[model samples]
Target: MRFTLRQLEYFIAAGETGSITHASERINISQPSISTAISQLEQELDTQLFIRHHAQGLSLTPAGRIMLMEAKRLVEQAESLYAAASEASEEVRGQLNVGCLTTLAPMVLPELSISFMSAFPRASIRPHADHQEMLLNGLHRAMIDVAITYDLQIPADIEFTPLVDLPVHAIVGESHPLARHSAVTLSELAELPLILLDLPLSAEYFTALFMKEGLSPNIAFRFSQPDIIRTMVANGYGYSLANVTPRSDTALDGRKVVRVRLSGENRPMTIGFATLKQLKKSRLLAAFATHAKSFISDAYIPGMVAPAMGQKKR
Candidate 1:
């Protein structure tokens, strides 16, 4: 075939992103290279693949849309063939597209990815951080191979392997009245201002905690980013709930934040790897999954405080 797999891959990226610039960033290739690949692919296929917009980027011609689907299937099959070869040789080597919850990515992925790469020098990982729903969508669409995330609203089509249970904790400024308490109840927290980490399904999970207890939080602020919420809590804006507590009892701005265990019956979120049920694990994916299982647990969660002893998994 005149068109190479690399060309097809570029076409897929461009078709998905709708922008050569975005596709280049997605695949870590130069804009010129992607542009050249797409142009060449269209030439080889003897058809116009995309309608070029002056500045708005490219839109797939109906033909481009059709090719994208086939290209993805071809690429997946190629990857599986390579994975089988690697498995036969007992060599874990390939690019793994890994997704993680945005909240967990900073604390978990860097260390886990670095160590995993160090252990298997032949392997490389590309990390994508997004909300739970987006991550799941990525898994279904084959945009990501696996996701490191919580067992929150997990759909049946995805399989989650539990590694650790992270119990929720209330974080507050050092001077906050409830900060000195050994543990605080949902009722007590409901009375105070709550700085909510408001991200898609994550927001639902946090709010559900309050709903389960028949109490509504006195939400003072809503922020999508966790660090901002931590900072807001540290500066005494309001207390916030979290599963993964930072090892340092301070926010990015160096303000002290205290993690007090949530008192009474509350569900702890299980951290684990999620993959599509139907997708066979590639050798690189399997190796990474094994590494993740070994690396993350109750005793040790990279860049975060270990789960408190005697914290029962729900």
Candidate 2:
């Protein structure tokens, strides 16, 4: 190959950190050396990988984005090949780039990270979280090796492995009249002001529940973050709908909320991992997936109660 692995590493560092200076600091290399590698890479590829921003940093162009994906896949494959050859008798170890749905980050990512790293000390894990679209984009770009998110709208290029089923529930403050009920239905719940989660595709899922019942939700507040939605519901601003329940009813602000099961024929969302359909699962990725499936079960998700005796799976 005309370009060396060292050049690809330098380019990846600069692309991730968005700055030649920061990339140099991160890898303990000189800024000029990093710049030279990137320049040489661009010359060989005949494409501008980054658009320089004065005093700010660099931004990856469309071509840069495509190249970044292939670069990551190549580097990961190379690392896996070396590990397999050198540690044939040893434990699986290498780098992992994992992502989670933004809503699931606060609820589950920390526990999964701590558990995985504790078991595989030699393996490096980088965890990231964003909305559904960005997470899918990351997967498609090979920036994230695997993701744990609800089955909202997965593209055809991605493959999802369902691990847990989380049904929608109504969130309300202790003082709300519906708080006394064990479960609430959409017809009755829709009469009250709704504090919408308002994330991409997520908003549609929540609202569609009421739409199926021929009812319209009276939306009082809309927020993209789940914690904010909980805080709003805890403070009695309005009732909200959620899938992942934190262990505590109290929000980060210390206001308490209650989770009431939703009644009716609404479909539950499947929580699972997403990866490129064609990508071969490295030992590191397989090991992580095994841990993740066990970490997420019907019995132990925070803020979520155990599934019903005859609960269905999708």
Candidate 3:
């Protein structure tokens, strides 16, 4: 079956946006054109790519999911080839699909993204913010070139390079008693109600901290978004644990939150890049890794505190 690159681009836009209309708007093409491209691609492949819903957006079938992954890789590769051909400079020129952890997106990604884009003006960088599981899935499926995230439960097929160690901080409301303290202990925090950040691997990390002290936190509320958890903690709902610390103490809702150091031998989470193990490192990927390391060393990324000047835990 012969499928044009234009068809794959339209299909990918629709699959990513989950709607033909949105894809049309995103790509500045007519809805009918996008629809026709999708239909032709599906007919060529002789398989259904999407489950159409009347009045609602479309959903990818199992085959559609597989196709989307391959389509993204192909589209990106084609773009890279075009970009390289258009520019004959010494600098590397290609597209990189980067992923960042949802919690770290606001704190760590923007500056690095801008710097990378600026350094390699000929190349394109597409960034996606998601949780660890989704980021890992994207990496496995070749949808994401490299990911900026914590050293979570990395599969054997993935490679992780640690850049900085972020120790967990205990967050509480300004009015809370523990807020005035410079540091708090797990056992001390265990007595208070906990507002858990119940993300896939993060929840386990926070819980394990308490378990090390032979105590279980009295979980009062649980949230997935870090900002929501911060807002709840600022509203005096309960104390929370987090590795990423915003530069400002104020929450999104204009409430004040305090960050206190955790007293004890709590293992710090390593922030790093994750990529497929056997995948060849493209020039774009190598450049990104090098710049990321330099950025951490230069202390240029805002809201991300530098690793403490002490012996790190192995």
What is candidate 3's lDDT per residue for 74-96, written digit by digit as tens? Answer: 88778777556645454667778
Q: What value of lDDT does candidate 1 attain over all alpha carbons?
A: 0.89
**TM-score of every model?**
0.85, 0.77, 0.82
Comparing 1 and 2 by lDDT, which wins?
Answer: 1
Q: Judged by lDDT, which candidate is best?
A: 1
Ranking by TM-score: 1, 3, 2
Worst 10 residues of 2 by lDDT: 305-314
Candidate 1's clash total is: 0
Clashes of each: 0, 3, 0
Residues 1-314, candidate 2, lDDT per residue (tens digit)? 79988899889989999999988875668999999999999999999999999989899999999999899788878877756853675576877888989888877887787889899888877778889999999888877899989898898989999987888889999888989898888888777989998889999999888888888999999999778888888888989998876766788798789888888778998889999998888778888999988877786663355464224321
Model 2 residue 279 lDDT score: 87
Candidate 2 all-Cα RMSD: 5.7
lDDT of each: 0.89, 0.85, 0.85
